[model samples]
Target: MSELVEIREDAPGGPAARALFDEYIELVRERLSLPADFEPPEHIFASADVFTGDGAAWLVIFDAAGEPIGCGGLRVLEPALGEIKRMFVSARARRGGHGRRLLRELERRAAAAGMERVRLLTTVVLHEACVLYATEGYREIDRIQPPAGPPEIWLEKPLYS
Candidate 1:
């Protein structure tokens, strides 16, 4: 299964990226029970220039037939620190080990960019994503209760330790 997949570094604004990101956003919105027109703040959603410029990268995972199935990004928060942003795998691609593979690739990308530790924020509604992070060695550090909606979970993992 792993052998049939390929992870490639790419721009986050491409067609494949657009499709994957749209699917990901919709899934999160539905799980959180938000209205169709709801728009999360930029900080909570897309951070500007995150997958561009220095110390940041976006990746898309492709299946054997060359269709994008999963995507993720690494954005530097500070010196030697990066955040895992927009990690997602499509519904049809779940449980195929693609998420884990995509995450590992992102970690490699982070290390190459000189990051030592990585952090990510996820909503409690995303059970599968939370489980994937835990299984990938990300430990929960904080649970933040927003004024509304489910609590957001913050997790951290060190690339070197």
Candidate 2:
């Protein structure tokens, strides 16, 4: 059995965390065959940027090998709301309930941070992720075609009363 691990949020910008974040992005791009222009924003990857009063809080989950296999974050948009961004789980780690765990953890953290609800944007091409969010109680709020790309769907869920 693979050993589940607990990750600390204190070292959110450390080397291991950063490397895993990069790998997670790469996996998504490859698996989804996303357009070249669909890259993640650079601000989230820049340690200084993510922490500089920005709307981001990074989290990572490591596997038995002490490798980060999953990650996501709560981007505080307001005192009672947050945005979930960059959620990813490696192929090898899927079907093991890690994604659900990560999602729950993120929601808990957001609630602890005083957020009442959390939201996220995702592409239709990522069908699995969309289904996962829906199953986890995220309701679709909108779908819009951005100026530079395909249509994106917005989903939101309340984390607290």
Candidate 3:
């Protein structure tokens, strides 16, 4: 089996990335059975904004064939706190260590940016993500029922000081 992986950081959010983002959004919407009128706002792409503005960094995993198989990113929420964002791996890519690779890259970038800690907000529906975070040294900070909809789980991990 040839090595089937690569990580990229300069990926931009043009038509291709936007299309992928939409596909991801559609999958989430279908899984959650969200209302038809519940389209996410443009600001939801703030993760991309942060990436472009240098306030965040994105890591994308590509298979040997040069197809994007997984992605994750980190946004600096405050001077010393980074927010992990948009972690996803295609179903076919699960259990292949892609997610973990993306996560480690995010952490490295956060540490390089001088962040002392990293955090992320996920929902109960994302059980796998919660498991990954917990396994990777993240601890629960709080749980909240936001005006948005579902119960939100917040987790944090300390980065290199």
Question: Whose TM-score is higher: candidate 2's or candidate 3's?
Answer: 3
Estimated TM-score for each candidate: 0.92, 0.79, 0.85
Candidate 2 residues 1-161, lDDT tens each?
A: 25576654635667766776667667567766766556565532334344324445677778877777777777777888888877777677787788888888888888887889998888786777887898999998989876654578989999864
Question: Which stretches of model 2 miss by more than 4 angstroms?
Answer: 10-13, 31-38, 41-48, 51-56, 147-149
Count clashing residue pairs per candidate.
0, 0, 0
Best by lDDT, which number?
1
Q: Which pairs of residues clash in candidate 3, taking residues 3 or more apart in a chain or in different chains? A: none
Each model's lDDT comes to 0.86, 0.73, 0.76
Shift in Å, residue 128, candidate 2: 2.2
Which residue runs does candidate 3 get wrong by more than 4 Å?
Answer: 1-3, 41-47, 53-55, 147-149
Shift of residue 136 alpha carbon in model 1, Å: 1.4
lDDT of 3 by residue, 35-140 (tens): 7656665433454767654558877777888777777778888889988877787666778777887898889888988889998878777777878888999999
Give lDDT: candidate 1, residue 158: 91
